[model samples]
Target: MATAPGHPIDVHTWSTPNGWKIPVMLEECGLPYRVVPVNIGRNEQMAPDFLALSPNNKIPAIVDPDGPGGAPIAVFESGAILQYLGRKTGCLYPADERARVAVDEWLFWQVGGLGPMLGQAHHFRIYAEEKIPYAIARFTDEARRLYGVLDRRLADREHVAGDYSIADVAILTWAKYHEKQGVDLGPLPHVRRWLDGVLARPAVQRGLAAI
Candidate 1:
């Protein structure tokens, strides 16, 4: 469903990789939206009102005034939000079945593998008070392996999937944090090239600057 005129989509988010995904999408689609900061550092996501919108208590939930059948709808989860926006605007998402399948595979890969493994690496290597070498090594290694997968995937193509779909945007958010994930891009040339190109987008810059 398309967003209503004068009633921009409400993006409940913070300054995070997941948080930046929605605004980047809205910017890419030229959809009007306003950021409603949910300061995760202050535990604001646990608020009852926010919880009603996002049962998972995630930072990047959205409240669309114009949803299916012209009703309001709230969507949680970064991957689902990307898919919703993609379908809503028909911008970066492909309509063709086979192409869409390709996009979904990489999108789910980011949500299930890349994002989480990199997040774990960040937590263990940077955020955790008691840094266990085992945990740090485990996640960092996983992060490196995931980056290797992406590097290989981009060896022949420009984007993660067929085109610059939501999959690229999803993976880009996490991949940009390679340094913090204990990964050196020196070994992953393709990823560095892809990341550079994605980061050069005006919409992405604006979305990141918004938060």
Candidate 2:
């Protein structure tokens, strides 16, 4: 669908997992947007302009020209951005109360639990200044446990939440970095299957390319 007159969606992001979420959603929703790359490595995310959009000093912020009541809107955080796009386009986000709740549950699950744990695992396993065995083992084990939970959740369903909502987009973004996070999917057949399905989408391919 065409955006409101004179107001296009501006996506500010890097090439990280979180950064990929917005592009994926925009593609999935068939919305037109502009990409503004933020080089986190050089501290561009901390710049005054980017910081105004994402006060948390993070990648994947957005400025929607046409927001609620036709005013421009700026949103930060990958999860919130997904929810905004979902609600705006009425594509991945469910309109029904129960279905929306289910989607929110898993979306929050990733934002609060899965993403943070895996991030710690990545820090300890790869980026840390010092190699701490205790930290590495602790986070890796937690990452494994979270993967198991997702594997079981996907045993009967093709998507994380009902009908491939924003929740799947949220978690799948992070789930793609299994190796970097020190996670093993060998025994998580269900998760593997689900990941394959999501990765096969043309929109997902285009979204990943945006990063």
Candidate 3:
């Protein structure tokens, strides 16, 4: 079955959680795709070609030629990309209506809450020109609060929802880096376990690798 020029997919990303999700999903879904690592730290993503697809100047964008009615599709926003990939190959997401919506909740939560909050903490603590104590506290506290949410939710379950799905994958990448970014994980034993479990997946390890 000859699909097209870009049959499987084309991903522009880097070696980050936000970036890692593409390769992770590709590997998990067992889809054949090309990997283009867009280095935002080096202004690679802002290049005119890359910007044409993802104007937000973010990594983790995709060009799926065999998308929606067998046409090319350009998608941005990690959460949106995740949902698309999940629907495409059917991994890390369920077919059940209720479970799928629940997975969407955690995915959106990570994209909105965990991703943004930890990003601020990293910016203030590691990248900010002036180390403002209040700003640092504000973001770091928010990061911990999000971690607390994960901890509480994971207290009695193995994954974010009822099963191991993209919901866990979407959040654990940043949660795993909490210590390196100066957020403590001492009180979140359940979260720690969940992170470890997700990282143990071969697909996850492959995802975290430099593309």
Candidate 4:
């Protein structure tokens, strides 16, 4: 089962926003993969085997048996995984340096800013044992501000980077969880339109259903 002829990707992931990115990319690339669930709630992500693939003790790592030079490759971080898949498949990720740079900008923006802000909003608003108003407002405001940036970016374009690349995949995964972050898309018509367009994609639908 480790080295099958057709199915070479073994996606070790959970059903989180970060976890869903890889599957969405894989599906978008038309790559065959098998999902190995990592139960983070039960500390499964801290296990030795899972940690070997994802040293950060995170879900959504992948083991690609047919990597560069036909060797296996294990990658962590949803952003890194998306970049690798785009490079390997020659899809989603642009070959042109300028276009690739554009994609990287939005992809990194989601990773460094959007995801963390939204995650903090979710924690303070939902998971935290003590609901601190200061923390809640801080994160919620940040999330709203970030959403405004994204909304403006998409005002004239269908996608973040002017084309539907991994940038859209990365951002939409977190954006789709707006309710959990206490986000309101009603005022951001451009973001709402872009989100609706991304959600309507057949690949996105399949990726969201992967888990």
- Which candidate number maximizes TM-score? 1
* Model 1 error, position 207 (Å): 0.7
**Per-candidate alpha-carbon RMSD to the true structure:** 2.1, 1.9, 2.8, 2.3
lDDT of 3 by residue, 1-211 (tens): 1122347688988877688777777777777788877877798988999989998888889999889899899999888888888897688889999999999999989998889889888889998999999998898888888889989999999999888888877887788789746777778899888888898988778767737
lDDT of 4 by residue, 1-211 (tens): 2222464599998888898998888888888889899988899999999989988998889999888998899999999999999999888999999999999999999999999889899889999999999999999999999999999998889899977999999999899988888889999999999999999988888888988
Better of 3 and 4 by lDDT: 4
- Residue 196 Cα positional deviation in candidate 3, in Å, after optimal superposition: 0.7
Q: Estimate the TM-score of every prediction.
A: 0.97, 0.96, 0.93, 0.96
lDDT of 2 by residue, 126-177 (tens): 9999999999999999999999999999999889887988999888889999
> For candidate 1, lDDT tens digit of each residue in 1-211?
1243557999999999899999888888888898999999999999999999999898899999988889999999999999998998898999999999999999999999898899999999999999899999999999999999999999999998988989988988888889999999999899999999999998888888877
**Better by TM-score, candidate 4 or 1:** 1
Q: Clash pairs of candidate 3?
A: none
Q: What is the C-alpha lDDT of each candidate?
A: 0.91, 0.89, 0.83, 0.90
> What lDDT does model 1 reach?
0.91
Collision pairs in model 4: none
Candidate 4 lDDT score at position 174: 92
Which ranges of candidate 4 are over 4 A from the true structure? 1-5
The better candidate by lDDT, 1 or 3, is 1
